[model samples]
Target: MKSLSLHFISIGGSVMHNLAIALQQQGHKVTGSDDEIYEPSRTRLQKQGLLPAEMGWNPANIHTGLDAVILGMHARKDNPELLKAQELGLAVYSYPEFIYEQSKHKQRVVIAGSHGKTTITSILLHVLNYHKRNFDYLVGAQIEGFDTMVKLTADAPLLIAEGDEYGASPLDTRPKFLFFQPHIALISGIAWDHVNIYPTYDSYVHQFELLADSLPKAGAIVFDDTDDMLDVIALKEREDVTRQPYDVHSYRISNGQTWLKTKSAGDVPVQIFGEHNMKNIAGALAVCDRLGITEEMFYEAIQSFKGAARRLELVTSNDQKTIYRDFAHAPSKVGATTAAVRQQFPNRKLIACVELHTFSSLNKNFLGQYRDKLDQADVAVVFYSPHTLEMKRMEPISPQEIITAFDRPDLQIFTDTASLQTFLESQSTAAPSVYLLMSSGTFGGLDVNRLGEQ
Candidate 1:
């Protein structure tokens, strides 16, 4: 690889910002432009001396000196910088395409599914880093050990990526994972998501099948045994690919710590809890095993994993009250997160509040999938911003619809953020209680940490 000058369009996104920093660290001159840059990204990019001096796209930033232009999904087709790059005949590529190019000579391990992809990818990166393995990775969420979520090195032999099912770029309709052409893949589980795009459950599931089928004959697939849908698809559709299925590993939580029981590794204590996380551990173990990591090493590394950001992340906790925030908006995610919180604090009264912010979660046809997902909570609350519905061009949904969709008669529905805030404030913090806030959005700009403090 040669030292090059690279410019990124819409570089403030989670993955894009990390890639910029990674390239900068690799001795590349990196420049980027975005219409807006938010808190952590702004601070991080500024710290790395990569932050754009201005906010919006500036055509002056796009010049002939650029080696290649990396395009993020955030940039619109008519973006000024993108158009200028095209006019100058500069080589332009989507983020995924660039990642694939970088890892073309390396072993690509893509973790794909409708949910839990981030968790699985994070675990793999954590374990690999524990053993001091030299590898590059692109995970959706922030991990503790790694300085950035994206890493690229000239000599790394492996590249781990979270294979999102959403469209890759404005010019590309295909899912991002399709381009990676992984040597090893893992499908955590499949459920209908991005209803605005896939339209139907079958259509949503076909994307995973396509990804599985795209693998080379020598490629490996580690699938979740808990997902019968994925199991059937793997058995029926993939003949050339080697298949490995993993379920929830043996685990027990005692005195607020999670312990895993494995045949070769024996008892291992972990910082993270949840059956879903245990299943993620199994999938990570399978991937590491394929990559030549011994069972003992894998267990030793995974036991210290603290989990990905905002996936049941504990925001604030005292003896009397504990609050967690999770990026769980899809039906399957909602169920898994709520269950995890309930299991971890069985003695506490669990108040699970989910915000229906995503296209699928707000879709009238897909709402039924959430039925009984919040049943485990002692009290369930569903929140949705009317402004979000308007922004998505969706019809207004009634509180009755949400209540009925969830199939919980005790469920409360709130359309106002202030009202929801008031309700949370009214809760008793004198006794030990768990407040599980689940959403892909920011709950109408509510300061969750502040609420947790109250």
Candidate 2:
């Protein structure tokens, strides 16, 4: 591929910024403008010599000399640079569309779902890397061995993408996964999420249905057969399309370690715990199978997989106390993470603390979907900032409403970080208890290491 001059409209975004850097690293002339760029991204862009001179969008930045204007989801349709690009007749592509353009000739593997996409994608990347298979990939979260979150190369025959359910760009209302046009597609499991985009549960589910239906007739789909909706979709697959349904692999947890019962390898020990993760491993294996990787090779590689960041990551641990922090804000994720910890350490007293920060979690109607999600925890507590609700412009949810939503009569609620942190600091870690902190956002900048120490 020739060196292309690409400009990103909102390069401050987590995925968008990484893509910009990846393109620059691949010898493309990358330039970007964002209203604001936050930490890590700011430092990274500066380090790469790709950071814009000024913050706000400039229509002046648009010129016919540019190869493409890559639009981020954060930029609105009426953004000035976008309008100028249209006037100048320069190609305007959403980030995902541009990704498709770059990898059009390559065989695409897209791992998609409402939850667990990142973890499953990371698992496949790790396994493939372990085996020394050369492949390009776009993963959501940072993994241990990966240098960049996004990578594109000229010679790789395959491109693996962590397909998000969110909108690709302001101009594109469809889910990001639809743009991948995957030859090998995997939908881990679907649950109602992104309430702002798909307001109703049925509407949210319809997106995944469309994603499955969008595949080519000759393509293959690997799905979790355990989900009723995904199961129905699998049954409806076209006659020519290959459908492989996967369930949780048989596994047993003992002495705080989870092991997979593999056919060829026998009992394979794993670094990541949880029955849900076993399902993730199964789905990843199916995709790997389609890519010519045998189950035996995959099992050998996956034994070293610890997990992706924030998917039940072990923060700190001691002889009697253990601390885990997970990105489990949605109802399904919350239930899975909390339950996994409890199952892993059944004898330990579990104190689960979850922070409600996402739009769905803070919404009135969506709150009730979380009923009994944290039932496994010995002490269940929920924390949501009143300021977060105000920032989101959502209706202020009362304590009683939250308590009723989960149907936990003894549920404790906190509105601020100080109170929550103070309460946690005051707790006794002397006995065998697991302190599980689950959230997609930082719990008001609460330090996990410091809190775990007490």
Candidate 3:
């Protein structure tokens, strides 16, 4: 990989900024522009001397001497810089396409699904890092030891990427995973999400089918057999690729601690627990096995894996209660996360609160998918901000509508954050209980660390 000048259209993006930093660290001359830049990305780029002097697109940044111009999903197809690049006949590559260009020689392992992709990818990376293996990766969430979510190196033989099903860029409507062309892939589970793009269920499932079908000859696809959709995909006759099915790993819950049962290592203790996570572990182990990591080595590395940030992350704990914050906005994720907490502490009263924030979760058409998702919690509460709906230009929903959608007459719904926080704080004083706050948003600026102290 020779040093080359590269410019990013929307460098303020989360992954885009990280990629810019990675490229800069690799001795590439990196420059970028974004209409708006937010915290972390802004401060990070400033430190790396990659931050744009001013916001908004500038065609002057484009030059014939540049190697290529990478486009971020945040930038529109008609962006001025993009138009300039096309006018100059410069090579314009979407971030995914550029990533592939850099790692075309490496064996790619992509973890794809509606849920569990982040967890499964994080687990694999943690295990690989634990054994001191040199590998590059692109994960969605921040891991404990990793500095950046995206990493690329010239010499790493493997690239473990979290394959998102969302559209790659404005110019490319295909799912991001399609660009990876993985040698080894894993489908955690398929549940329809991102309603704005994949309007129909069939369309959503088709993206994953394409990924499965895209594998190279003798490639491997590890999937969860428990998912009906994944089951159908895996059953398809394909001699070119290997279909490896995995189920929930053998594990037991003892006094609120989950332990993995292994033949080589007696009952290994792990930091992360949940039925969904057990399945995630099984999928990761299957992929690791393909990567030449033995079961013994995986279990040894998994014991210290705390899990990806915001996926059932522990906020605080005391003598009689524990509080967890999770990024579980989708229907399947909400159900799995709530059930996992319930199963983890069956004896304790579980109070679960979920915020409807994502476009899919707030839409009335998609609300029915959440029916029975929070049933496992002793008290299920839902929070939604009217301002959020207004911002998204979605129809305002009533409490009755949510009640009907979830089919839970006892469900508590709040349209304001203060009221929601009040209810959660009141319940925090109860002894022998667990609190799970699930959301992709900030619950309208409600502070979890303060709420956990109540």
**Candidate 1, run of 10 with poorest lDDT:** 232-241
**lDDT per residue as tens, model 2, 280-326:** 98889889998889988998999888888888888988887889989
Ranking by lDDT: 3, 2, 1
> Higher TM-score: candidate 1 or 2?
2
Per-residue CA lDDT of model 3 for 1-454, tens digit only, reads 8898999999998889999998899889999999999987999999999989999888999999889999988889899999999999999888788999999999999999999999999999999999999999999888999988889889999999998988788889799999988999899999999998888999999999999998989999899999999999978877789999999999999988999998989999999999999999999999999999999999999999999999999999887778999999999999999999999988888999999999999999999999999999988999999899999999999999999999899999998878888888887544688999999888888878788777
Candidate 1, residue 389: lDDT: 92
Sorted by TM-score (best first), the order is 2, 3, 1
Prediction RMSDs, each to the true structure:
1.6, 1.1, 1.2
Q: Which stretches of candidate 2 lie over 4 Å from their true place?
A: none
* Lowest-sum lDDT 10-residue window in model 3: 423-432
Tell me the TM-score of each prediction against the true structure. Answer: 0.96, 0.98, 0.98
Q: Model 2: clashing residue pairs?
A: none
How many backbone collisions does model 1 have?
Answer: 0
What is the C-alpha lDDT profile of model 1 across 135-196, one tens digit per residue?
Answer: 99999998898888998888999999998988888878799999888999899999888988
Clashing pairs in 1: none
Candidate 3: residue 91 Cα off by (Å): 1.3
**Clash number by candidate, in order:** 0, 0, 0
